[model samples]
Target: MDDGSAPAAGGYVLGSTDREMARLAALSEVYGPVTAAWLDSAGLRPGATVVDVGCGPGDVSLAAAERVGPTGTVLGLDAAPRPLELARARAAAAGLRNVSFEQADVTRWRPPAPVDAVVGRLILVHLPDPVAQVARLAGTVRPGGVVAFADVALSTRAAQPELPLLTAFNAWLLGTFTRSGRPVDMALRLTGVFRAAGLPDPVLTAAAPLERGGDAVGWSVVAGDVAGLLPVMERTGVATREEIGPETFEQRLRAQAAEHDAVLVNPLVVGAVARTPDGGG
Candidate 1:
């Protein structure tokens, strides 16, 4: 893997204490089961080995362990130790000896053996070289091993009308990430990454956005949130508000929260599965 210069190796923006990550988990809990199901359906056996990349808090790692049963093993790796510690604690609480979590930049890390499946959720987007990383991941799969991944588009558009301010804010937010070269569009371009890395074409699937109302409403509760992202967006000209009226965002959040049914929209998450050149099932 040539240890390509790592991008924010251990500085992943999504941290345990970050409010945005907290809200994201709340929403993604409902959305991620679909992705987990696909991973479970692919290359899983009583003794299969699965590698979960960017395995934050080991939710998917533990889940994969359960799916593969005690006979199988799940190794989840991440660049950050905070998430790994949480993942370890979770596994410990569940007595999931089959699952292990380690901390290392995946770009410089390699698996001890070719695994049955290599998976990552919302990982590649943060990478400086998404294509190269995908290729590197392909190298970890056993002959005919599977690679499954999922991510979302930067923009979460909806047919339903939205507050003009929120709509504009969302648009600016998308550009902010894109300018930094980590656009959410990676959700769909995974096929390109695979092809560019010379891996087999994948079977792709999608899960559409589901509304998340209640206390979770407002931009603060979405992807990056405006506060943590405002500085970056402003520097890049992705967003510029003339004035942020006091508690305006808070009021909007409260309003949306009250609706409880305010339909939140997001791009469909695209998931893919592919095999290595060899036909080892």
Candidate 2:
């Protein structure tokens, strides 16, 4: 749902701090349904095998395990070891024996064996060459396997009544991403990226929730991200801790939302799923 995964060459702006890890969990909760729908659209079935790239703490990997059932297996790969450890614990706690987590650089990782499908969420945005990476991932699957990915589109953020604080934070988030050299609109470009990856144009879906008032999950999602990104925002000159007031950010967002009676449309997430060509092209 929210940010995860470091680039193969390193520098994932959202560092792997405890605060960031908690933020990622909150984000997964918010984005879980959307990602579930994406996996369904990818045609995961019982007995299918899947490899989840940049799986973070295995939220999506665990979901895929449920989808593919006991007979199926899931291998989740990420560049960070701490997240992988968390992912392992989560799977263990959930009693999901079918899913496993591993630590590896996404660009350099290879499947131990050909799998039914390859999937990722909120990962490509961190990569320098997503198209080539997608192509490589596609090749790791079986002949008719699926290649699906999900990413965020920050430009789609809006507010019905226009809460001032929400608007300001949205701008800060977008600005930070832009200045940090991350494509703020990777979700909007999935089609082109998939096609350029030498795969067919994917079936695309976009989703965003209109979170209303202070109590909504969106508030926490944004606040958590702001907390995680505070350092980057400061280093990149996009924003400063003093200016952002991380300690009061969530409170301020809730207060403004309550004051304005607004409904905030969270960032849009775009998902794309394409099938590998026959004969494993």
Candidate 3:
């Protein structure tokens, strides 16, 4: 959920285009397992209500709805209306009546009532002040309710054979994000964010997908991200259109993986799960 709602705070660098939405769908596949685990650790159960902040296309929101069962409800919020529209359509397609979507700036939006949990993924990094935002979200949940989030740590990407193209891809991703003024290190800072939010110390877990040989989904995600950020790369001088060669980006990445019999490790996604104070501390 890029903040077209608040451009001065540096709107979501990755624009909410169809291509970016597709990238998010692919990313959901990669992230689904780890996210489910995070929710489990946070004790998100059936009959609980959750709010998915910055829910692009409603992936996480839909997942939470499934976990919370028919009696529970999920509200998916995003600053971009396009994703919210897509999210509604997806919920309908999935026959998930318990989940719904809305468009609003997370920093300013307030829930009508306290929920059982408030969650987000890949959202805090785009915020101007993640700690304050976490505190605000924490406030939206009932005392002892769950507050869980996940973010990428690009620096955790690695390859066993150290493929050059993979290296370049990592550099392009990190450079573009850094230049956009987003926190590239948000994953590592989750603990401090939770502590400062006045929540209990969160249980942190991090995982990276490893792909070896043949055509890999990891490469597709990388290519999709580069494709989505081409304009940003050019604007920020991270890399130029000619240099990236978006047309063959995936092919080049796969070719390198095959040639070196390399094992590619995608970025690490870190999850933090904590509960609001039972005493409302």
Kindly report the root-mean-square deviation of model 2 from the true structure over all alpha carbons: 2.9
Per residue, candidate 1 scores C-alpha lDDT tens digits across 70-118 of 9999999987666687789889999999999888878778887778888
- What lDDT does candidate 3 reach at residue 32? 77
lDDT of every predicted structure (CA atoms):
0.68, 0.85, 0.85
Write candidate 2's Cα lDDT for 1-281 as tens digits.
Answer: 12443223324677677877887887887777788788889989999999999998888899999999999999999888888999999999999999998888889898878899999999998887888999998989888789999999987877778877777788888887877678889999999998998888899877897777778777877887898777667766788888889999899888888887778788899889999887733
User: Model 3 over residues 1-281: C-alpha lDDT tens digits?
Assistant: 34333233445877787778778877887777888887777777999999999998998899899999999999999988888999999999999999999899988899889989999999998888989999999999998899999998878887779988878888998887777777777888899999998988899877888778747667777878888778777877889989889998889888888888888787889899998888943
What is the lDDT for 183 in model 3? 70
Candidate order by lDDT, highest to lowest?
A: 3, 2, 1
> Which ranges in model 2 have alpha carbons more than 4 Å from their true place?
1-10
Better of 1 and 2 by lDDT: 2
lDDT for model 2:
0.85
Q: What ranking emerges by TM-score with the best candidate at the front?
A: 3, 2, 1
Clash number for candidate 3: 0
Candidate 2 Cα deviation (angstroms), residue 29: 2.2
The 10-residue segment of model 2 with minimum total lDDT is 1-10
Higher TM-score: candidate 1 or 2? 2
TM-score winner:
3
| Model 1: ten consecutive residues of lowest lDDT | 1-10
